[model samples]
Target: MRDGIPRFVPEDNYGKSFGYQWNLHRLTQLDSYVGLPVSRDRLLRESGWTTDELEGREVLECGSGAGRFTEVLCQTGAAVTSFDISNAVEANATSNGRFAGLRLLQASIYDLPLMDESFDYLVCLGVIQHTPDVERAFKTIFRYLRPGGKFCIDVYAAIVAYPHLRQLLRPVTKRIPPGKLYGVVQSITPRLLPVSTRLSAVPWVGDYLTRLVPVANHRHLGLSDTETVRTWSVLDTFDWLSPQFERPQPRRRLERWCRDLRLSEFEIERIRGLYVVRGTK
Candidate 1:
């Protein structure tokens, strides 16, 4: 660590877009806003783990942007090692710092600081797809799990058409400065939100129409508050638009990774354009 702060080679940090976006919406996705811990629910559903399964477990949560899911993991009474490749971990630290079962680190998935076979469970959500190399990232994360240790990962589905538009727009949008791109998304999100909501209601063709738009439509994500929706709309849209790399991977590819690594009892499924993979080492 340089000057008492972790210093990564500039090339390894590919999450400046995420850092910019999450700092503003640090607590927006947490359960405190609504009576439901939706983030927690998503984790449990994706990993096929019950509440009791997480208690006292040692979990390594990679790409823990803004600590949304970090809070959920900590709430499970588990010792969580959360890391992100951006300054967003600062927001994570501020919000979840008081928890005794938490350890926060700012590190890239490709080059994490932890030792091999050091964790009981490894979770990398909303992350692998955004990495420069999905397969390599998967291999690297797999090295952290102990023999028979379990892991759950979620990434954008490679076959999904929604991401095609983002890929089309990213060449130009990603070139724009983070602040400027954020400004562009912030101003247009409110207007596009209503358009997205209206078009999403058009019967048979609504979902496709909504997907055609470049903005993220959270209408069907089970989110309920207006302000929360609006905030998430902007943040998630910027998320889709601003990433340097956003390659969605297919279930087959994930299964291939598991097979190549000789992982046992692995399961891969797609849910709402996201591929969820759970496996045992």
Candidate 2:
């Protein structure tokens, strides 16, 4: 393997923005780095899989950006095969390479180098919406799951008739090179965050007004430290704007997809503005 990590896709592709951002903010979202269980909590809640259940099982993690969840998965004593469509695999390896039972690869979700019905569990979080064809990507990954294997995924939720400020700016922001776009986000976040924070406190208008500001302010997340809040704001704001594809799907549509796949015991529910789907094949 090149550089001690398996490479499937070319070093540059549509996920370049993700690769750049994750490498730059390598440790930003990791629970180990943040001294919080944010990543672990989300993984557990969304997957409904306890660490005890995962121990000694096999888990295939797609779109493992910077290994935020990879770190938690590796700690579970599971054999974790984590891959990304971007060079974020490098960042993931840097963060979690030392963990036993962890394998890092740079690969596309559409064309994975794995056997069908091979994995016991598959998880794709905050990823499918970024792919060119969400359904195809889902089916491709699902093919890798063994019979009775469990899966968990989350996608951005569609809001009917709502004018999302991020979507309005993405056309321009996504076209800009990720390195330059990151700088733009950094410069604007400090200025707009204060205003957004103030507006977010207002009753009804606050949510609307806060949307007008492009920066992602995480004041409500209980990050007590001001510097940490600022760092998260800048990182998340860049993440929000720099993606090449950011498709949000309706909850019903996601449920329909699960039905089409004939995934048993499947449920699609909203969690923190994302539609999280969990089921077994």
Candidate 3:
């Protein structure tokens, strides 16, 4: 183990963008850092698993960027084994290394080192769509879940047929180095935020107008202030443009995967912009 964490993947990979961004914005999405239960609420809502139910259970967390959900899972008293295909594992360790129940690793979903049918529960959030092969990644991780184990995951929803402004610019933005891409997003967010913020209030067309710009503004989401909104905007916008892959799955597709896998009591629904699929093995 290197730096007190197991390393299963190379230091550089397709997830380099995530490693870069999450390390820079290490605590940006943490519930504790934000003084809000944003991560906690989402974890509970999407997984439909309470802390009491998960206490002392084994949970395998994939794509644990900066340990936002790791903190929440560890607090549940679960034996949480979390991994990512990037150096974001370092950031996760920095943020949540103190948690006794947490075990951090740098590993790929397709090649996890753990045994099959080992975990009591599994959760992969804000990650599937970013993988090179979403379906195969899901199947690979699902193999490790024990029978009757609960699993939860979320992917970008393929709801819109037309490309948004972010999609239109991804060809150029994604090619730019992450550092340069972050700089560009940071520079543009301040100028366009007011315009997007203003348009977001214009009733029907307001949301559409805001989408035309590439920057992400979260004023309507009720952040503390404009600066917080800007910070989130820059971070999210970079996230949108810097990923090596950004695939969105349709609701039916998610349903088919669940059915094909024979996952019982599965529910596939759009929650807060992601297609959340949860079920039992």
What are the runs in model 1 whose C-alpha is more than 4 Å off? 1-12, 161-164
* Best-first order by lDDT: 3, 2, 1
Candidate 3 C-alpha lDDT tens digits along 1-281: 88999998888799999999999999898888888787898899999889999999999999999889999999989999999999999999999999998988899999989999999999999998999999999888999999999999999888651357889888888889999988888888899888888888998888778778778777745687667778889999899999989899898888888888888679887775678899899
- TM-score for each of the candidates: 0.94, 0.97, 0.96
Relative to the unseen true structure, what is the C-alpha lDDT of residue 228 in candidate 2, on a scale of 0 to 100?
89
Residue-pair clashes per candidate: 0, 0, 0
What is the C-alpha lDDT profile of model 2 across 35-127, one tens digit per residue?
Answer: 989899989999998999999999999999999999999999999999998999899988898997998889999888888898999999989
Every model: Cα RMSD to truth: 2.0, 1.3, 1.3
Candidate 1: C-alpha RMSD to true structure equals: 2.0
Tell me the whole-model lDDT of each prediction, alpha carbons only. Answer: 0.83, 0.88, 0.89
* Model 3 CA lDDT for position 144: 92
Model 3 regions more than 4 Å off: none
Clashing pairs in 2: none
Candidate 1, overall lDDT? 0.83
Candidate 2 lowest-lDDT run of ten: 158-167
Residue 4, candidate 2: Cα error in Å is 0.7
150 in model 2: Cα distance from truth in Å? 1.1
Candidate 3, residue 8: how far the Cα is off, in Å:
1.0
